[model samples]
Target: MRTTDLQLASALGAWRRPGVALARALADAVGGAALDGRLRVGSPLPAERRAAAALGVSRGTLTAALDILRVEGWVDTRHGSGSTLRLPPEAAMRLAPVSAVGEDGAIDLRSAVPAAPHTAYQQALLRAAERSGPVLAESGETGPGLPALRSLIAGRYTEEGLVTRPEQILITSGARAALALLTAHLRPRAAAVEIPAYPAVLAGFRASGTRLAGFRVAADGWDLDQLHDAFRAAAGGVAYLVPDFQNPTGALMPDAARRTVARLAERYRVTVMADETMRDLDLRPAPSPLERIPRAVLVGSAAKTVWGGLRVGWIRGTAALVGELACHPLCEPLSAAPTQQLVAAELLRDPARVLDHRRTALRRQRDHLSGLLAGDSRWRFTVPPGGLALWLRLTDVRSDVVAAQSSAYGLELSPGQSFAADATCAHHLRLPYTSPITTLDRVAAVLDAACGGQGQGPRVPGPGR
Candidate 1:
């Protein structure tokens, strides 16, 4: 796990800030990379001389930066070997559940996952327990997934206008696992991805050595011409999309755009991997892209709609492709825990009721947060019809600087650059509305203080619980 000088330099993008010290900026960039999972633990850094040359810095400056990292527990240097990336215990805890309140009660808006529906979940758990006797008798290994669960997932697609069978479904630990398995199976030379996508997905593609051909996704929606151009450029490669209430941005692609994307994918002979993890969280009516592109492999997860703890997700593809993935070397022999699968099945049996409850709660939170930010002239954002977060455009402040300053106000934020394929969205910030109304109320105050609000402005009324 040795990092090349070039690789290290690329990972440490735009480290030179105007007022920040050179060494501190370099160290902070390295630490940010570690937090973003771009630099894996135990990966030795390139030699000091090579790194200095790659970054166009003097050896002394590079040494000072390494010293900073060492003190912060982001790096460990042995006598012979160079510094290796690492995360201190406290820093590691930041990667835990997104719902976790940080030390001293810091508000973390890093992830867009919602709080679970406790009543529905408890009822489902009770049903799962009742059904566990028969499942317990069999060997715990259910390769493709529990038969009932797979059938339910397949039926979901069938109802959505994509004809599917149980054989077309392959359950995985989570949506991330499903993506990893697809990446390994496809083995594409390159991939066409949205400019600002889910960070983990970008990191996974980069780690796999896949050349990324990024296309811009504006706040409004996708640029079809650019998408077509990217598809033509990366012909025979893979195209990863989040067309249903896209993450971070929450822009839903219209049916016309879906047809265009499907046609472009076909013309270019490219493989499409459509992630629909956020589909069920729709705050409004939207058409499914699966209706237009039957060849595309669909990925869905219970993590967002149900509970992240469930860790259940599935891939919907052709029967033959599903069989191949089930037998892939990287595929886990069993899916998520048997009990969790049963719970998911029970919930899926009457998904509308569960989803209605979730949508109502989310809609309230989303509107409350939107109202709070709407009064602030410095911030501008469109209220997305559906999705868990608001992608905000800061008029006069850099998102990274705002995020750093927000920390002083007991807030944790993911700067927009983290979502970019090449680390370039400095003017944006993603604010999730998954927190309680009380917490979201505090968010307005925190941001106001952090950004130095011009005046009190007109405060919007909070949505009552």
Candidate 2:
């Protein structure tokens, strides 16, 4: 593919880190493009002087950047011919996940998965294999799910204050599959999901062709009034709620709010889908009302509480509704991955031990991050009770600018804009303190430098524009 100076310039211009050499930053940008396949291997980079002019950088600076890329083996530049992306097409296309620091030595905070305790997880797997069942006869996919796993899940829910039965369960491939299946079942004309929701939820609605509305989660907790308004605004459509440990923000809805939300869902006659993936991740107990409502469907997953790679999730609702959801074209019968199911069930057997261990470590990490941030005034946040990351508001800086520029400083961050339904939280950022404490120390320093020009104020989390 032929490339132009304008295209390179456009891609490179988005990143700008203060205190970093212009050439180094530009090199990281160019390298990122090459790794991502935007700069095809056989395609020559734009003519040097012209590329520099187009990118508004001095020609010398551009040459330095090119040299860095050449040294990194991403590009090969000839005296007479222009530089070309050196990564082979197939290799580039199949590139491994780029490390946050691999491009420019940035500390990575972008990936949200938590580290599972290796010993505990492996032990569960061993126990599952020991208790393995005879291989079932050949059969095509059937969706109601493994009878054993469903029964285990039902009993688990019952203990959590929600009375459930195996008939009310529908096993899904993962949380995303559940969302997609639910979306297909509702066939909504309109929808509302908490702003900064799990990205898969947004993608599900988009794929299902539903127009969506958003109401923000208050920084402190759920704002029932906003949620009610959002539900009412949806008219007769559907609403997705993550009342426990909401992603990005980590706000656990108070018991009062949970009942109020249930009331609003009924009052507005909207089908409610509550995500309980994070409910199990909480250090303390939160409200549980999944068994109370008829129209509201509840989904739970092992992705958060257990290992993320475990592709196991389930939906809880009336038997009839769950039966209908199970038949969704997207639903399949991996519900009984012999090893996966047994491992999850074994872990479920000791939920308290596993969750308690995770909560204790997470709280320590959270406190470590808070202590690091005590002297910095550029960003602020109320420490979440329990969640994967810190959702912080940049006091006086544009989150977009900092996020864009942070790549240059060796830190890859999720800009708050990605979570906003309307991209209005450009001044916010979600930083994971879940990483190693030593790593968090470096991240704090980098963050402080990045927010050098940010303002001083607190902005309420509200519906983004």
Q: Write the per-residue lDDT of candidate 1 for residues 1-465, one digit (tens) a residue.
A: 799999988877656644457898788778767765667777999999999999999999999999999997889999987788987643532322334233235777787776566667787889999989988998877788999999998997888778789999998888988998899998888889997899999989988989888888865899887888889877998999998878888988877888888888999988999999988777865533434455788898988887787788899988899999988887764367777888889988888866776786678668777876775778889888777889999989999999998777677789999999878889899988876544566677677766775735323222221
| Poorest 10 consecutive residues by lDDT, candidate 1 | 456-465
Model 2, 34-151: lDDT tens digits are 6544566678888888898898889999889888877767787777887887752222222112342233344667766664556677777788877764423325343577677889
Model 2 pairs in collision: 101-106, 106-410, 106-411, 396-454, 396-455, 397-454
User: Model 2, 202: alpha-carbon shift in Å?
Assistant: 1.2
- List TM-scores for all candidates, in order: 0.75, 0.71
C-alpha-based local distance difference test score of model 2: 0.71
Strongest candidate by lDDT: 1
